[model samples]
Target: MDRQTRSLLAHADHPIAAPLDDDSVGRLLTRAVVRDDARVLDLGCGSAAWLIRALGQRPGVTAAGVDVSAEALERARRAAEEAGVDGRLTLHRGEAAAFEAPHPFEAVLSVGATHAFGGLLPTLDAALRHLAPGGTVLVGDAYWEREPSRWARETLGEYEDLAGTVEKVTAEGWTPVYAHLSTRHELDDYEWNWTGSLSRWALDHPEHPDSAEALRAAARHRDEWLHGYRESFGFVCMALRRTTDT
Candidate 1:
């Protein structure tokens, strides 16, 4: 399936689009958005779900999100309006790595989007460019909970174990102020929702042009998750601050 189609199906059931429960998301946002009247930026902010939630919880916060998907940005715009935070949110359609803002934000978020910048450290580099001094970054990415099989490594790319993952960021001059390792329930929930949402869409719209493709894609993804990476793959989200002056 195409990227847009995959994204639409993947996020149909879960707006956060990661293996994180609502409570976890709320806690992470609370840690990341520490400053009063904070300005926040989300790179590769898919549908801007995080920003919408943050803006809703904290009226003094303003946010901007950049993503390459016009469709996703439209969804974000509509969602923000529904939440009555459209005035406090801005959406930009562009490559997040290439996006530039006029002013630095107090908090930068790039959850589950390190792939857009090639890897975790590069994503942090991008966030650093747009971050104010003493600002925090909220980043999330996959890790290896155990030594992965060759197929799993090839499928998901190589990642360090949780400790090594944290070491990498700290070595790059960021300290993890708070972190969350997704529980087994959260991981299974995400995969189930991802596959189920797509499968349901296909079942509901059997006559649609992409129905067959969507069904096949969903089945393939479900199989891959159950057999390919279920035992070893893990996800971590961290609220990080610079360890030194940039």
Candidate 2:
């Protein structure tokens, strides 16, 4: 959500710590309470990061990744095969905005893609649709500036609508498990580390012209977030644990 995070995710697998660190991600997987034989659905799963990580670290769980990008899906597939987790990790190319559950997943996760789906409304809708009762959904996105003077919308662009999105989720059946508002330094580390790896990988994959360009373009598109938010940028990630009690 911050400039640094945007940069890092743009360069996922960088030598440094991305805005979203591997340790934090691993901790998310560990805390998810995924039961034996539980099925996990990863929305916008680029390179199957969470899926592959879960398979390697946590056995007896099925991990499935869905994304709109065919190239991203292929990379995810390759990663699974290489990890020898292909049997348990299923990668699919599908629309993230209105993706349907192939089956009810025990856990649903969407990383930076939550912001891409027009803030929280569509994201929560998709996650709720796929989750079984008592399922979990992990989401990470940008937050507001610290103790803002003007409205977030006036200063921030698309992210201005995030607050309302958070409200809608609470009104829905999903209960917020964690809303981590990370500091600037944390976000900076994440973006740098994440995107650094991505840049290298993109350079290596000369076949993907668009992806390479996108990697380069990350700075241009996200320059504002990094600059403006750095003065007071924030990171927010919430894991919604769905319950029939809703």
Candidate 3:
């Protein structure tokens, strides 16, 4: 996508950038068993909603957010300032795998941005690499809700079944500690809010060079969801921790 479309998608009012609502955010945070002043990293953090919430809930905690979109990071900076956590947050603009820090974090998170690391299993590896020993890694990922036809499967690209997902994580030496599957309502909200934001942007920027393209892209995504894979897919935030010897 072009910078204009990316800017539109990263609009300040675009709701939660992760594929989750407020409730799921709370659950994922709780699963981390955060401690006061813990250091956290959010891969593909979008506009820092999760980090802001974490800072609010845990006094003195510090966070770092990495995303490739300058537009998204711009919004994130504003959000951190508005939340009074600007001083405690560091924002990086880059791919998640290339994000380097002074040290590993107590918790690492990625939501709906696993594609940056290529796919689900690769994302797991990337997140864990930056995780402190026994630290938590919270991943928001999707699985087939039901079997899909060949056409639908190809359209949605590749995904593991839930059982296979769990198995993959376990095989990677992480133990699943908490899991929250998104409801249909939450999923619908994420999809609609994203497209709705783009529509609003296109309407507001009718004279801009990219306006038509943005509008067309938004419409295409809406149609794809409604007619193609909406019913056959599901999302979850699974919290995992490195397995340690007893």
Q: Model 3, 100: alpha-carbon shift in Å?
A: 1.9
User: How high is each candidate's TM-score?
Assistant: 0.98, 0.76, 0.93
Q: Provide the RMSD of all predictions against the true structure, rounded to 1 decimal.
A: 0.8, 5.1, 2.0
Q: Give the least accurate 10-residue stretch of model 2, judged by summed lDDT.
A: 9-18
Worst 10 residues of 3 by lDDT: 4-13
lDDT of 3 by residue, 99-199 (tens): 87779898999878787888888898888778887789888888988886676789776788888878988887888899988889988888888788888
TM-score-based ranking, best first?
A: 1, 3, 2
List candidate 3 stretches off by more than 4 Å: 1-4, 7-12
lDDT of 3 at 21: 79
| Candidate 1 weakest ten by summed lDDT | 1-10
Which has the greatest TM-score? 1
Candidate 1: tens digits of C-alpha lDDT, residues 1-246: 588757777788898989999999999999999976999999999899999999988999999999998889999999999999999999999999999899999999999999999999999999999999999999999999999999999979979999999999999999999999999999999999999999999999999998999999989999999899999999999999999857
Candidate 1 RMSD to the real structure? 0.8
**Model 2 Cα shift for residue 87 (angstroms):** 0.8
Clash tally, candidates in order:
0, 18, 0
